[model samples]
Target: MDKIKLSKEEYENAVDEIRKFFECERDEDIGNLQGQIMMDFILEKIGPSIYNKAIDDMQKYMTEKIDDMYGYMIP
Candidate 1:
C-alpha cells in the first residue's frame, strides 16, 4: 500500500495539535520548525502502523455489522 499523505490542512492541524500537547503536557511551547520536524518523523515512522490499525478497525466494524444483518435474515 502507498504511504498515507496528509493534506496541507491536516498536516497543519497535526502540527498545531503537537504544539498544544507540548504546552499542556510539558508546559513548554514548541515552535513550528520543531513541530514540523516531529510531525514529519511521526508521519514517516508511526503513521503507517496507525493507518493500518484504523483500516483493520473499520474492516472489523463493517464485518460485525454485516454479520448482524445476516443473522436476522438467516434466522
Candidate 2:
C-alpha cells in the first residue's frame, strides 16, 4: 500500500485542528511545528489501522450490495 500523503492545505488544516484541540482540551498552546509533528506521529502510528478499517468497511458494504444483486435477476 502506498503511503498516505495529505495535500498542503489538508496538512495545515489538520495541524490547526490539533492546535485547537490542545488549547481547548488541555489548556496548553502548541506551536505549528509541534502540531505538525504530532499530526505526523498520528499518521505514522495510527493512520494505517484507520485506513484498513475503512477498506474493510467498504469491502463489507460492497459484498452485501453484490449479494443483493442476486435478487434482481429474473428467476
Candidate 3:
C-alpha cells in the first residue's frame, strides 16, 4: 500500500496529542518536529498491522450482517 497520509489538520492534531501524552505521562516536553518523527515511526512500524486488524474486524462484521440479511429473504 502507498504511504498513509493524514490531512494537515489530522497531522497537526495527532502531533499535538503526542506532545500532550509525553508531557502528561513522561514529564517531557516534545516539540512538533519530535512528535512528527515519532508519528512517522509509528505509521511505518505499527500502522499496517493496525490497518489490517481493522479491515479484518470490519470484514467479519459485514459478513455477519450479510448472513443475517439472507434470513429476511422471501421463500
Number of the top lDDT candidate: 2
How close is each model in CA RMSD to the real structure?
Answer: 1.7, 0.9, 0.7
Q: Which stretches of candidate 3 lie over 4 Å from their true place?
A: none
Candidate 2, residues 1-68: lDDT per residue as tens digits?
Answer: 66678999999999999999999999999999999999999888888899999999999999999989
What's model 3's lDDT at 62?
A: 99
Give the 10-residue window scoring lowest on summed lDDT in candidate 2: 1-10
Against the correct fold, how does model 3 do in TM-score? 0.95
Q: Write candidate 1's Cα lDDT for 9-43 as tens digits.
A: 99999999999999999999999999999999998
Model 1 stretches with alpha carbons more than 4 Å out: none
Error of 1 at 54 (Å): 1.0
Candidate order by TM-score, decreasing, is: 3, 2, 1
- Top-TM-score structure, candidate number: 3
Give the alpha-carbon lDDT of every model: 0.93, 0.94, 0.92
**Stretch of 10 with least lDDT, candidate 1:** 66-75
Q: Which has the higher lDDT value, candidate number 2 or candidate number 3?
A: 2
Q: Identify the superior model by TM-score, candidate 1 or candidate 2.
A: 2
TM-score of 2: 0.94
Task: Tell me the deviation in Å of residue 31 in model 1.
Answer: 1.3
